[model samples]
Target: MAAALAVTGCTSQSSGPSKVSSSSGGPAPGDSRTPPHSAPPRSPSTSAATSGKTPGGGSASGAGRTPSSRPPGQGAGFPHCSPGTLSASLRQLEAAAGNRYAALVLTNTSDRPCRTQGWPGLQLTSEGGGRIPTETARDRAHEAQPITLKPDDRAWSRLHWTVVSSSGDAADGSCPTPGALRIIPPDERHSLGTGWDLGTVCGKGRIQATALSTGEGPAH
Candidate 1:
């Protein structure tokens, strides 16, 4: 019925016989010239998104996000140093009774109190690094101590830098070098990136680099 009405309309548009289309169905005149209605074409200038990139590598817009772990502006899964502030350096290490100890400088470059929890811990890995971990240590020798420092303030704490294994079968007379990590930095906080290093608390007696206080594990 719609086709018959369209044919009648065409007959009225002209005199005599109207031209017949060979096509099965013919679109109205000018229809082919018209663009189909659609969402506006994507803007040529529209910006594209990126998945991930290094911190200093790209603009803030293209700046790739980090892997999911800690939230932005909060601290959680940092390896050793916290974000924002400079991390302290692992400067010095020294000999101890059965095991060795390390001295670290908790320096706050920024003018703020750096809050940290637990003892600064070091990992003791053997030269061979065997399975079942025959000789190694992990985690800080933490105690009931919370660290707080005023702007540019430096405080000291000591840990059993147990360089040798329990059996006392050390690789060499010297203790294997250690890799250190800071206590988990708290959320909504920052630390002074400020280089901290391993230093021994040596005195007429013992590992005196960090202050002498009993918390956990045998004293060095």
Candidate 2:
């Protein structure tokens, strides 16, 4: 009986060890739970890294797009002329049949070369700096050409008006004499002023002007 009891106690102790070993061999609940939680953080970080590259690629593509238009004279390696770098003068031409004519001359006073094209803006003012009623009409018969003016080079425009009064003139059949002439370069805002002694401009102060051309105007 003593030997049998000792054998039975040894069997119970062995069974307890086997149960403990089996439970430990299987995956721990903490290990499974840790992997699932840690795995979610890695997935979000990977997606964030991928999304960050998309905007950088989009910006690179946008930088390759072309502009719709370029500024004038940009292709010629020269800049547009400004009023500050120019000097203006008037050359009176011969008068015929109640018509008067003159040449508006512009000289490049700057050392650098500049380009200009199109019609210029003109206005007449009284001696007291008062605005006069002047109408400038373009002569489309002449096409504007781009002119490159070197230092001290010149460009000119023809100006023609009537000295005699027309039906549009005031009832007195008279016109106001301009004391100053304001000349604005093409594509410029500021103006250059010169003295004007031309007696009177008729037909409601209308003046016909031509596009600028290279060199001094014809004396005739």
Candidate 3:
């Protein structure tokens, strides 16, 4: 079973939408990659402090995997963690009509070296039916917000959730239904201004959803 992290003394980690965030003060003189919203402890000359960014997002093909043999960063050994440590977070949870959407806040909390990753994909459950991947708007957007977490650093971004609607634009005001989890990956990205439908299923208690993979394969 996956365990929750509760150790002390270490920097408390968190995840949210990482599309936008002003970097913390104290940027290196030569590194402009560090966005204004990057994590803190910003030094004047520390190459390691600058947040690294990857190429375009990775490909995610989730639908064919044996339970006993999951992919890396998954399965029984998974931390089963919350938004913390994760690169993004759901800053705001909103409800319009009968639909629900989450305003995500993505941030980096480590100091050594790490890069931003993935669009916030969703595996949502339909109202009187089954689940499906929420519409994804990962590609339509850009990751100009650089987040480099020093020993004690932070950065943030706010993003909206994709819903089960085909007539509304994500920026125009479309929300997702209840039960969804944002997808995070290092090597995959969604189509520009488009969304994928995973047919997610809703469960009891907190909203039900899972993160999408960052490669071209079947679900686990």
Candidate 4:
């Protein structure tokens, strides 16, 4: 009886160890099968560079780049010539029918082309920087024409005034002599002029102006 009991006990102990070993080798309940691998987030600049884009939203074909300047008459959108971009001068062209005639010439000094249009705003000023009141006489027969001037090219307008009276005459009276002419380009508020000696007249419309043209005009 004692021998039979020992064999049973040995069988049970061997079976118990095998079962424990098998259970230990496997994953436990509620345990994950493998650890997950996470990646880092990418930055916006890095993403844009890889996609052939600039941080400023520019593309590979130069889109969003600074636009080059355009010439006049290519479109109405072309900018007009500001006084800063021009050099101006006046020359008496002739005297006709008891009136003095002169050409106000403007030369484009910029590298780009510019438009000269409409009538130039005109005024007379003293050498002391005081505004001289004068009347503007528009040439009714003259037309407002737009002219395009390329670099170093020129445009001109005509001005006519009555001969200065010496008597300070009461009927065609005399006024303060002007030291300069104030010229404002068409559609602009800025002015340009140099020393001028247009003797003053008492009446309105003493001086008349024509619109800008390709050359000096009696035919604007």
Candidate 5:
């Protein structure tokens, strides 16, 4: 009878330890089962890698995408007008005093709309494409404003120059005639060429220009 009691006591002690260990609610060192509510925290890198996304909310694949080259205030729908997409023309105005005047017209030849602003670069060239002496001065009396142009639409800039020679010009008041005029749009390196039929600009090839405006310039 004592032997049986000893066996029972040993079994109860061993079983109690097993029950206490199981109720501890912790994973054993070599236990294959994960403890309840003890999931590993997700790391940012792991999450990003799994979702194929960057921390900036952009796709990982788009991280290397090129940015838009359009200038500020210019919408994606209408880019700034480039010289290659424009055609240049000239309108001779009535001569006044010793100064001659004309309007430089720029027409959008592209199918899409474009924007333009500020003064355009002007140059005079010979018939053989040789560069001629030219000087352009901007008239800031009128402020420059962005002008949007649709296909076939136009923008104009006023040009004024003296036909009479200044002290800085030749002694005979004679000036070289330009066969072609090169018009470069603002912020562009390319130019559009147009014929120059107006007579000589006598003030050392100097001409005054205004910022581009909407529609055609003054008629007279």
Candidate 6:
């Protein structure tokens, strides 16, 4: 009886250890079924369409726009004549006592009508391309008149100078002869180069001029 009890005890002990080892050594059947890997959620910037905007977060259409054409005759409101649109000519007129006079004529060459007013800025240049000093004077005789020129309309100004001094001595600067006149229209920046050969320009401020007019005739 003692031998049989020992054998039974040993068998129960051996079977207990076998069952525990089998259960702990390997994974369960349900655990072997792995959960699928899921990707991370995307940011708002990554999905531009969902945010109702372009990738740059602005409107895509009409990216670059330009201005439309300007209205007609808008530039004609203050149409002042430029030097390029007029022809300048000069001629000797008369001599009284010691003073000499000449006419500077400007003719419209453009198709449209333009206007000019005030005295012209004049400077005498030599044949070798040297600028001779001169001073301009306002003429109370001829008032400032806005001369409007059509396609072929013309205007004129009288330039006067004193070749002799008050004491009857020759004026300073050796009285150089002028080859060409550089004329600047009123309120204009550009100057017109016109041929001019009067006689001689003397000291500073000796030259004077009357404002342009439509009534002034060409110097004969």
Model 2: residues with Cα > 4 Å off, grouped in runs? 1-75
In candidate 1, stretches whose alpha carbon ends up further than 4 angstroms from where it belongs are 1-83, 90-94, 121-143, 163-175, 178-220
Select the stronger candidate by TM-score from 3 and 4: 4
lDDT of 5 by residue, 35-78 (tens): 34333359987656556532222221211111222233443235
lDDT of 6 by residue, 158-220 (tens): 888877644333454356677877666665545676876777766443456676677446536
Model 5 clash count equals 0
Candidate 2 lDDT by residue in tens digits, 1-220: 0010000101111122211111112212121111221332457778676554421121211111111112333314345566778888988999899999999988877776666765665667787766676666666566677666767778888988998988888898988899877776665545777889878888777777787777778876
Candidate 5 regions off by >4 Å? 1-77
How far does residue 77 in candidate 3 sit from its true spot (Å)?
A: 27
Residues 1-220, model 1: lDDT tens digits: 0012111111111233222221123234221121333444466543233335333232212111121122232221122223344344443445546555543444444543333332332222222321111111222233323333334544344433443343343343433332223221222122222222342211111122232122221223
Kindly list the per-residue Cα lDDT of model 3 for residues 38-126, writing each as its tens digit: 46575765546455633222222222211121323222222221244445444444445534444333333333323332333333334
Work out candidate 5's RMSD over C-alphas: 33.6
* lDDT against the true structure, each candidate: 0.29, 0.61, 0.30, 0.52, 0.62, 0.54
The candidate with the higher lDDT, 1 or 2, is 2
| Candidate 4 per-residue lDDT over residues 92-121, each given as its tens digit | 775766577788887777776555565565
Ranking by TM-score: 5, 2, 6, 4, 1, 3
Q: After best superposition, candidate 3 residue 205: deviation in angstroms?
A: 20
TM-score of each: 0.32, 0.64, 0.31, 0.58, 0.65, 0.59
What is the clash count of model 1? 19
TM-score of 3: 0.31
Q: What is the lDDT of residue 124 in candidate 2?
A: 71
Q: What is the alpha-carbon lDDT for the whole of candidate 2?
A: 0.61
